[model samples]
Target: MFIQNALPQKPNLWKYIIGLIVVVFFWRGLGSIPLIAAMFTKASDLGSIDMTPAGLADLLGANLFLSVMLSSFVLGLIGLFLYVKFVHKQSIRSLTTSREKIDWGRIFFSFFVTILFIGGFLYAGVMMEPDSYQWNFNKEAFIILAAIVLLMLPLQTSFEEYFFRGYLLQGLGVATNSRFWSLVITSSLFGLMHIFNPEIQKIGYAVLTVYIGLGFLMGIMTLMDEGLELALGFHAANNMTIALMVTTDWSALQTDALYVSSAEPDLGGMLLFLGGMFVVLLGIFALRYRWKNWGNKLFGKALVLEEETTA
Candidate 1:
């Protein structure tokens, strides 16, 4: 039913291709200008800029740089909503869920659920390896970071969910008429999108499994839940918690978080831990939602209902 929402629009492959191009133009092309300009100005003042996360944080100051970085997604989201409305003749509600209204309840539930897990795990990690973490909290910096995280980071994560799970998922499912392939392609692209993350350089290519695994987990959640609310909440919480709770040199975004990790990431153990957590979350969601019809919902063909076309 979620993917079928696209059916009434008579989804053409070209529309999706062109739509993506437009969104990316706003997101990456025009959106990057401010950040680039800021970096250039900073470099000119400083005589050289490092360009690494830490370097940029130092150059532009963490909160300002983070704001500029996330501003891109804001523009991209605007571009996407415009295209979906005018070009595709689809409502934002339809892009979000089959439900009559966007479910804020589900979003908050998922958000708090993820926050609990992240907080719990972080506490455990700090206790188990006291030497790995240092108190890095600065009251003024943290207050600023909190404001940015609360306001701007959601836009970034929302953009990703709307693009990957909402737009591309529906588009691909309609194009291939196969839910399975749609999940696979979108999840893979989501993973590939993170290939250049600083974590890869720090933790090695094996870390990609974690990213890909996250993509699959989010994709499965989207398909099973038939909405982006859960995925959106989960994604936002995951990033927000990380941004608020911790920072490390090799991290993609280095901020004045509460703690800084000095320990080298254990890729193998992290993979297993995260993989297990994914399963547990899935089980919880499955039980709570009472998800049924796995065969049809996940792997079955996506058909355009005649009623949808007529309506």
Candidate 2:
């Protein structure tokens, strides 16, 4: 597969470790510097970044916060790229899949599919509150904003997926000598990382069941498919839909997206999220991707690598 070719024919454990640390320093540590400064300066509380466009605008204006957040991601990207290119000595494409190149088809297909799915929700919102919706259609600014959001946001989401599900999943799998452990660890960490999200506070801890469930879904898809394509598509679509379709008083990302929605989230409880997740999992299984040794895959031990060589 194209992804296989992208990886180091022989894994280099040291490079992976160093690269992860480098990524964390830049993407996370450096990224938080601005927020930290703001906290100390009393410029603004961290929780102020809201779901509305105006709220997003305020946060973006904070140079330190923006610098740290964006630079950290860039740093992480560079670190991962270097690991893939030099340590693994593999083409960028192989890192994602065994494909020779990025399958624009997969990306677009997922994009459109997600749009259609979320578009349904948007339609419902509009139907419910026709007067509440308004289009601030400035051709030029809208175009630029759309481009920026679509391009940059997807990169951000993809970075998360690659790092957590792809790189971390593989590394942990090799380290623990068990894919199951890797999946559990990766998914758990993924969900835990979002504990600080503003949405949790707005909607309550019940919403986190959805977040963690979503993480598990993404991670499981990666493990079952033996690649990140499906998860990447699903995640990009999910985020893009959220970005473009809705805006609320209490949500995480604030962007000048296409549609400004005012719908209070109904699926704000654990039971709803679990039910939704169960449905999605069933659908995936219906598609016949649920392979043999199911019990082992979800919670089995990972394969251990030799100490001397990870290749």
Candidate 3:
């Protein structure tokens, strides 16, 4: 089974929530038409919006961050809120699986480990090229920009995480009475959603094999760990570092970063990314969460053929 199917069944509400999400996606993509027609479809301009090729292309024609946020990001959030409040009939605490309430330990552990990982890379980069990275420390301007980005960007990233790995994972698991299919469908959709990223254009579609692999990795973490806390922390750290530490002309999430790497992103970096994610997964597994049915949890069928199955 992919999900435990332990939650109280609520089919009618679930349908409404799903409808709202579809509506949000429709408007978001459709609404981008005007922006796309305005810009010549430049990647850099869209990077400022949310780092996706579609959004960046829109920026190429019309580089207005506010419109993108107002039309797409905010609409999505409002839809999510409606889903949670009206459709799911769930509180934030309930949606997060508050068996013991919020798990601060898991969140902090993942957060601290990510800080160390990113710090190690930064240290290595500095040692390798001291003169390559000049500090961009306009404190006043940066502080304001940082505040704006921090406030806005997390909504975009967190919405993806909660929707794909948390809300969808849990809902589908419950709906199907299986955990396995939840992971498969959720992770597959997550990766497919990124197909239009500018990085795919610059680095080839093969890079997304690793990306799909990552979706599986994070999905496994959510299912095995039975929560999104760790995945959330890791994702937040990964993106926050990219937003604050490095900015590339071809990269998503272009910002006033601390350093700009001259080296092109390569296959080696993709391998390293996969390697690092597995390492973290291994560490979590080593913590002995007592996770069970490893194969079924990740790759098996989600349907519960037997009533006695616990999922």
Candidate 4:
């Protein structure tokens, strides 16, 4: 039903291809100008600057750097909306869910549940390995960071969801005529998008399993639930929690979080632990949402009804 929302318009594959280019130009090209200008100014002052997340965060100050970095996504989201509305002739609500309206209830439920889970895990980790974390709370900096996270971070995460889970997922599903291929391609692309993150360098390419795994989890959620609400909420909460609770040298974004971790991440152990947690979460979601028709929803053919095409 969600994928079929694209049926009435019959948007060709080329539209998606060109849409991606437009979104990327807005996100990476136009959006990066401010960051580039800031870096250039900093380079002139320091005679040189390191071209890394940490370096940029340090040079521009963490909050300012983060705001500028996330601004790109805000622009990208705008571009996506324009394309979806005009080029695709699809309503934003249709892109988001198959429901008559956007389900704020589901989004909030997933958001709060994920936040609680992440908070509890962080608390337990801190308790178990006290030496691995250092208190890094700064009253002023944290307030600023919180404001930015509350406002800008959602836009960034939303942009990703709209692109990956919403736009691209639907496009691929209709194009390939199979939910399975759509899931696989989008999930893998989502994972590969993070290949250059600082954490990958610290933890090795094996970390891609975690990224790809999470993508699959979200894709599965989208397919089973027939909406992007849960995935969007989960993603926002996951990043927001990490941004607020913990920071590490090798993190993708170095934030003024409440705690800084010095622990060397154990890749294998982390994989096992996260894998177990993902399974449990999936089970819980399935139960809560009363998900059924697993075989059809996940692997079924994406069919466009004749009536829908005529309408």
Pick by lDDT: 1 or 4, better one: 4
**Once model 4 is optimally superposed onto the true structure by TM-score, how far is the C-alpha of residue 70 displaced, in angstroms?**
0.8
Q: Estimate each model's TM-score.
A: 0.95, 0.73, 0.76, 0.95
Lowest summed lDDT across 10 adjacent residues in model 2 is found at 1-10
Per-residue lDDT of 141-192 in model 4, one digit per residue for the tens?
Answer: 9999999999999999999999999999999998999999999999999999
**lDDT (tens digit, per residue) of candidate 3 on 151-193:** 6655666666767876678777766666777777888888887
TM-score of 1: 0.95
lDDT winner, 3 or 4: 4
Worst ten-residue run, lDDT, model 3?
A: 61-70
Candidate 4 lands at a TM-score of: 0.95
Write one digit per residue (lDDT tens) for candidate 1, span 207-275.
Answer: 878877888898888888888999999999999999999888998878889999999989988888788
**lDDT score for residue 95 of model 1:** 93
- lDDT of predicted model 2: 0.62
Q: Which stretches in model 1 have alpha-carbon errors above 4 Å?
A: 45-47, 304-311
Better of 1 and 3 by TM-score: 1
Superior by TM-score: candidate 1 or candidate 2: 1
Report lDDT (Cα) of residue 40, candidate 4: 79
Model 3, CA-based lDDT = 0.63
